[model samples]
Target: MVSDFRKKKLLHLFNKFFDRDGSGSVDRKDFEQAAENISKLRGWKQGDAKYKETLDTLLKVWDGLQSVADANKDGEVTADEWVSMWEAYAKNPSSAYDWQNQYCKFIFQLEDASNDGAIDSEEFSTVYASFGLNKDEAVAAFQKMAKGKANVSWPEFQELWKEYFVTEDPNAPGNFIFGRSSF
Candidate 1:
């Protein structure tokens, strides 16, 4: 189970992702818009192969989240449902762990711009920039993960994500994955 502090931080990040319209709730349209923005960020031009691939992956993620959080099948995730979903995850952190593993897999595909099956420094920097990190901070974090390697493979990144989300160690390289968190 995550500590209270970490859980709060996770919840904050969850809300940030789900509450896309600033309307205090998440709907199907919000998911579509978020997917569109991510597709654009990945430089996917309309009708391109990667564009459909990336968009499909993102929509799958959205569907997964909706399956978990949309209790009423109303096509929207109300604030209450969102809180309930997190509360359930808090009680059973393994559920969150599994969800995060799938999330990371999707992110890996999206961030691996070169289709190399791994993330190089440049790709890692793109991810950091998306999270609002500066170049120096992103470089430092990537160096820590590199540990003499030129890239981070999927398994290595899974370990990093586990550490980042499941551990409280202040010095964990995964802590820097999301840039500087306000929490």
Candidate 2:
């Protein structure tokens, strides 16, 4: 069973990402807008390699969310569907972990500006900031993940991602991944 704190966090994430239109639910247009925003933030243009990469990543994520959260086959995610999905995920952690693991790898690849297979604090900060983290919060999160080191590897990132989604501790390093937000 998911802890109350974890449940709240999951809802917060759902509301943050899926409820873009603030219409109390999420539809295809919201996902499309989000993808467009990401592409714009990355400064991706048509015919560019990075554009294709970013587009693919965004589409993958959008598809995943829609497939998993839109339980009624209505092409929309309601609050009930969102809650049901997380509850089901809580019962089967591995499925959630597998999806999140893949997502973390995608994020790592996007943030590793040098293509070094790891991300330094500065790169980490930039990525988190794009997700709404302030500069200081992003740095703190980086330090927490780095654990006195200079960079974070894929395995370590996977751990952090799991903790970020599953752990209830507000002060946990993973909690800082998305920066300071009211839970």
Candidate 3:
């Protein structure tokens, strides 16, 4: 299951662009505009090859989940029309492993401190630099092996992976929580 911290961060990021009116909730136009803007941000310029390519990619992604948003027989997506979109995205479906893989690759690119296709302590700090953590907190996480080594064991890697997406805290406010399951 996902962690509250990750949910909060995703919600914050989603709201920043989706909730254009600052109403804490996304409206119809906001969803389309946000998608368009995201397309533009991804090196898609008007009348450019990359623009069409990126839009096509987005359409492919959204079309597969059309029922989640194309609710009114109008072939368009709305804000309320995307309730399932966010939920599905947040749930991290097994079938969407490629999506998660892509995200991981992005993080790896940002965190590869050694720039050798692997993450170490320094890479993790650079990736999370925006947090502005003090030296002590940063050192604690690094010392604790928060970032996996060049050759990380499966068990050890899962722990580091969980830090960004799965909170171990039992009292966190979120729809899902992670822990040792008996089943």
Whose TM-score is higher: candidate 1's or candidate 2's? 2
lDDT of 3 by residue, 63-107 (tens): 444544466757554444444454555456434444344433433
TM-score of 1: 0.72
Each candidate structure's count of clashing pairs: 0, 0, 0
- Per-residue CA lDDT of model 1 for 36-108, tens digit only, reads 6676777777788877776676667667778888899987777667667666664555556344566778777
Write down the lDDT of every candidate, Cα atoms only. 0.67, 0.70, 0.43
| Steric clash pairs (candidate 2) | none
Residues forming the 10-long window of minimal summed lDDT in candidate 3:
174-183
TM-score to native of every candidate shown: 0.72, 0.79, 0.40
User: What's the CA error at residue 55 for candidate 2, in Å?
Assistant: 2.1
Q: What is the lDDT of residue 27 in candidate 3?
A: 42
Candidate 3 overall lDDT versus native: 0.43
For residue 157, give model 3's deviation from the true position in Å. Answer: 4.9
What value does the lDDT take at residue 60 in candidate 2?
A: 72
**Per-residue error (Å), model 2, residue 176:** 2.3
